[model samples]
Target chain A: MERRVKLLGTGKYLPARVVTAAELDEQLGLATGWTEKKSGVRIRHYVTTETAAQMGAIAAKRAAEAAGVSLQELDCIVCASGTAQQEIPCTAALIQEELGLSRTGIPCFDINSTCLSFVTALDVMSCAMAAGVYKRVLIVSTEIASMGLNWKQKESCVLFGDGAAAVVVGQTPEGESSRIISSAMQTYSEGAHYSEIRGGGTMVHPRHYANGHEDDFAFDMDGRKIFRLTSQLITGFVDSLLAKASVSKKQLQAVIPHQASGMALRIMRTKLGFMEQQMVDIMADHGNVIAASIPMALHEAISQKRVARGDCLLLLGTSAGLSLGGIVLEY
Target chain B: MERRVKLLGTGKYLPARVVTAAELDEQLGLATGWTEKKSGVRIRHYVTTETAAQMGAIAAKRAAEAAGVSLQELDCIVCASGTAQQEIPCTAALIQEELGLSRTGIPCFDINSTCLSFVTALDVMSCAMAAGVYKRVLIVSTEIASMGLNWKQKESCVLFGDGAAAVVVGQTPEGESSRIISSAMQTYSEGAHYSEIRGGGTMVHPRHYANGHEDDFAFDMDGRKIFRLTSQLITGFVDSLLAKASVSKKQLQAVIPHQASGMALRIMRTKLGFMEQQMVDIMADHGNVIAASIPMALHEAISQKRVARGDCLLLLGTSAGLSLGGIVLEY
Candidate 1:
C-alpha cells in the first residue's frame, strides 16, 4: 500500500517588535496611502538579530511537542530559510543544535526557494516519506525578511517581517483523512530578474566591498512586475494543484496563500473563487514573511478554528525565481 | 506495481578556464606540494562572471537532447545549485527561462544540501515519479564555488572549481534494471561549524556590504574538521545505502564519491574496502565543484566507459550543514 504523509502539528513565532504603517512612513518618507491602500499592510514584525534563530527554534520545538513527538524522534529536520543566521552549514543546522536535539542522529539542512522554500521542502519530505526513506520529518520555514530590507527604500522595506512556522510530517497508513494528497511546483526563471536582492550573492562578489563598491549588496526589487506575475501565477497554480489532487474548490475549507500583501491575498481568493471567509489572510499584521507566511497563516487559521478535521486546505506560495507552487492537504 | 525511475542521459559543462596547481600556488603565494599533498588536487575549472543558472541551463539542454526529450515533455526541473544567482525566485527558474522551457508547465526550483544537493534532487524526483506525479524530471547540479572563495586563503581557495552536470530521470516499467533502488540523506547540524561561507546570506545581510564589511561575505572553512567528518559520514552513508539496496559490497560496479579531493576518495575507498578501480576520482583535475562534482565525475565515467549497463553504482556526497547522503542505482 502507498503510504500517505500527514501534517501532524503546526506552530509559528513572530518577532516582538511591531512596526506600524505610520511608523514605517516616517522612517522611509513614503506616502501613507501606499501602504494602506495598495498593499493593505498596516503593520509588520521585525526581528532583532538575537531573536531570529531563537524564534525559529521555538516554532520547531512547539511543532514537535504538538505532534506528540520529541526532537529525538525526527529522522530529518528541513529548515526552509531565505533569511538565514549564517551563510554556511545552513541555519537549519544551527536551529537543530540550539534545540538541544543535536545528539539524536537527525539530519538537518536548509532549503532555499525564497518564499516557496517551505513548500518545496514539504514536497521533498513527502517524496522521501512515500518512498519509505523517512518516517517523520520536521519542516521549518523561518525568515527575518526585515533584516535584509534596504531600510531606506520604503517601497520594499515596509513589506517584510520576521517570523517562523513549522510543521511535522509523518507517514501514515493509506486512506487517512488528514494527509497531503498532491503537490506541484513551477519555476519561472525569466521572472527571477523581476524581483531580487541584487547584492551579496556570487553575482555581486562581496569581496568587491574592499574597493568601495559597497552599494552592490542591498536588496533590489521590480515591484510592479512581481505584483502582476504573482497575481497571475498563484491563481493558476492553485487551480492546477486542486485538479492534480482531484479535489474541488468547494471542498477546500481554507486556502492559505503566502502573506505577501493583503491586496494580493484578496485578489488570489477572488481568482480561486474562494469566499473571503474561506481565505486565511495574515498579511495585515505580518506582511511578507516569505517562506514563513503560509505556515503562519495556517497556524492562525487552526487556532481560530477556521480549519477542522477532514477539511481540505490548499497552500499556495510564489517568490523570486518567479516560482509558484501549491499543496493540497486534508486536515 | 511500483514504477521505477531511470537515468536516460547525462551531460556536463565545465568552464573554459583551467587553474593548475602551480598557477594557484603562485597566485596565493603558497609553496609547491601543498595542493598535491594536502588535497591531492592538481587542477580546477572556474567560470568568469557566469551565473550558476546559465551553466545549469547549458548542461540541462545537452542532457535533454541526448535523452531525445523536448523541454516541453519535462514535468519538473530540479536545479541543485550551491552558488545560486539570486536569493529569491530560485536559480531553477532562471534555467527554465534560459532553456525557453518556462511556459512548458514544468515545475522548477533549486534544491540545496551543499554538495549533496544533486542526490537530494534525485531522491526528490524519484519520489515524485514513484508517486506518479511527474513522468519526466530533469535534475541539474551546478556550482560556481570559485566565486565565494578567499583566493588568498590557500587551504579553502585551492579546493574549489566551477562546473555543471545534469541528468534526465523518468519513469520506467516495474522491474527495470537501470533504476534508482534506494537513497538516504543525513545531516549533522552539530558539524555545521566545520565549513561555511561566513557572509552573503541573510545572516550577514547583504546590506551590510555598504557598511564596510567585506570579509563577512567570503567563504570560510574549518578544513580539518570537515575532512574528518566527511570521511566518516561518507563511509557510513554509503554502507547503509548499499545495504538498503540489497547489494553486497562485491556486487558494486563503481562508487562515485564527491570530487572534493583525490586523497579523500582514495582513503574512502580503502576504508570502505572497495577496489581502487571501482572508484571514480576526478578531483585530480576538477578539485571540488561542490554540488556539481559527482555528476561531473559521472559524466566523465560514462564517457570513458568506466560505468556499464546493469552495473551497480553508489553515489555519495557530503558538504556544509555537515550533510551527507548516498544513493544506489542500477546503471
Candidate 2:
C-alpha cells in the first residue's frame, strides 16, 4: 500500500514584470506603505509579455534539466492549475506545444483543485506512478491571477501574483527514501462561494458580459470567512495528516505550504503546532500564486536546503473548494 | 502490472428540452431537412432549466443508486468535463454542493482532457483505485457545450449538445474478471488550435470581451483540419490501444466512443475495422456532448446489453488537446 514515487526535480518561473507594493499603492490610490503593511507582499511578479503556458514550459524545461531528463522522455504531462491558458485543449497540451513536444505524442491533460491543485495532483499522480501506469511525468502549475483580479476589492486584489512551477517525478531509485507517505483532502463546499469568479463559464457566458454581469468576471474573496473556516478545521486537519502518515510533528523537517498569506502562515505556526523555522514562507516575495504557490515555495525550499534527503516534509493548503488538503512526503 | 479496478455502475442524463435538427433548421434560417442532412443529428438536448452541476449531480445520484452505494459514502468526487459550471472552486466542488453533501467532506476535484475527459479520468482514477487510494470513487462528466457554440460557425455549431453522465468505480472482486486492461493517450498538439474556445481563461480575460473580441469567446473549429489530423492518426492509435490490451478487434463486444461527429464515427467503422453492431452510436440523438459523450454512450451500452459481464469494451476518442485516447476494459 506504499507509494514509491520520487520527486526527481523541481523548477519555477516568475514573470519579468515586478510589481512592487509601492506601485500597487499608487495604482489603487492607497496611502504610502499601506499596500505592503496590509498584504505583506513587498513585491510580486505579473505577466507582461508572457502567457501562462509559456511560463509553464520554461519551468518544465528547467525541471527536466534538474531531473537530468529530456522533455521528450516524459511519459505524461499534467497541468495542475486553477486557471487555464485557454478554455480548450487543456493547459497541458499548450505547455507541451510550448516545450516543442507537439509531435512527441506525450499524453497531456489537467487535474484541477483550484489553489490546492499542485498538492492534489502530486497525490493522485503519485498513485499512478506507484501503479506503474507511467514511468516519468511532468506536473506544472501555472497561473495568471492578475488578469481577473477585482481591483476594487483591495483586500484580495493585492494578494495575488502570476507565476509557474513544475516538477518531474518518477519511481524512487533503489536506495532513495523519496515517496509520498500519505495524503488527505476534504471539501467543505458550503464555502464554495466564499471565493469565486462567477464568469467565463457556462453560468455566465460572454454574451452576458455587456448585460450587467461584468463584475462576475472578476475574482472576489471573503478573506475573513476563509480565515475563520481554516481556523476551525486546520488544527484537526494537520493532526489527521500527520497521524495518517504515522509521523509526528517533530519528524517534519520542513513545511512547504501554499503561499496563501502572511497571516495564514502565522496561523500554521501558532495553531498547528509547527515551529516557525519549519515553515517555508515566500509570501513576502511571491504573494499568493494560487495553485502555483505550493510548488513555487517547494522549489525555493529546495534551493535553500530546508529539506534534505530522507527528510520528512508537509505540504498543506486551503483552496476555493473550501477544500483542505495535506500531504506528507519523504524527500 | 494489471489494473484491477471495476466499473460498478453507470448513469446519464439529457436535458428536458430536445432540439431536433428540424428546429435548428428553422432557427438558423436553413431549409427543412438541411440541418439533419448536414449534421446527421435528429434530436439533441439543450439545457433550459438546469445547470451543468445540477445535471452532473443527478447523474451521480443515479450512478450511486445503481451501484447500491450512497453518495455520502464515496471516497472522492471527480468532475471529468471540458466545460465548467463556473470559473473558480473547480466544477467538482459545485457538483458536490449540488449533491447536498456539502458537509460530507468528500474530496472533490477535476480531470480534464476536453472531449476525452471521462475516459482519461477513468484511466487515471482506476490506477488510484488499484493502488488502494480509495475504495469507491465517482466520476461525472457534465457539459453544456451549447452555451459556448459559435452559432456563426455552421459546420461546428450543429455538432454539439448538452448532457451529463457518471460512473461509480471500485476494486474488482477477487473472482470477478472486471478490470481495465489498458489505456493509451497521445497528444498531437499540432491540432491544438484546430478546435478551441479562446476565452474563459487567462489568455483572453473577460475585460477584452467587449473590445472587438466577442468572437474569441465563442467555440471555433476548423472541422476540415481536425478531420485531416484525426484521419492521419486514428488508425494507428486504435491499433496501438488494442495491442496494448492484448485484445483483438473481434474480442471487443462493445466500442463506446466520444460522439465527436457522425463522419468521425464512420471512420471508426470503415478505417478502424470495428463492426457496425459492435459500436454504440448515439450521435443521432445526442449530437456530441463533449466530455459527456463517451460515458453517456457507455451507460446506453450497458442498458442495451451491448456489453455483458466478462465482455471486452473499448472506449475511444479524439479530444481538443489534439489528444487521442483509448481504454480497453473488461466489462
Candidate number of the best TM-score: 2
lDDT of 1 by residue, B1-331 (tens): 1227788778988889998888877777778767767777887888875787788889998998878888788888888766676555567777888888765657776677788888877876687788777888888888888777776567777888888999988877576677887777777766777777766666676556558666666777777887777666666677777777899888888888887666667777888899988888898888899888888888888889998878888888777877778888887
What is the overall TM-score of model 1 with all chains considered together?
A: 0.94
User: Which window of 10 residues has the lowest lDDT sum in candidate 2 chain B?
Assistant: B1-10
Candidate 2 per-residue C-alpha lDDT over A189-308 given as tens digits, one digit per residue, 9 for 90 to 100: 989999999988899886787889978989989999989887898889989889989999999999988888777788778898888899999999999999999999999999888788
Using Cα atoms, each model's DockQ against the true complex is 0.53, 0.83
Q: For residues B93-114, what per-residue lDDT tens digits would candidate 2 score against the true structure?
A: 9999999999888999999999
Model 2 misplacement above 4 A: none
Go through the candidates in order and give the clash count of each.
7, 0
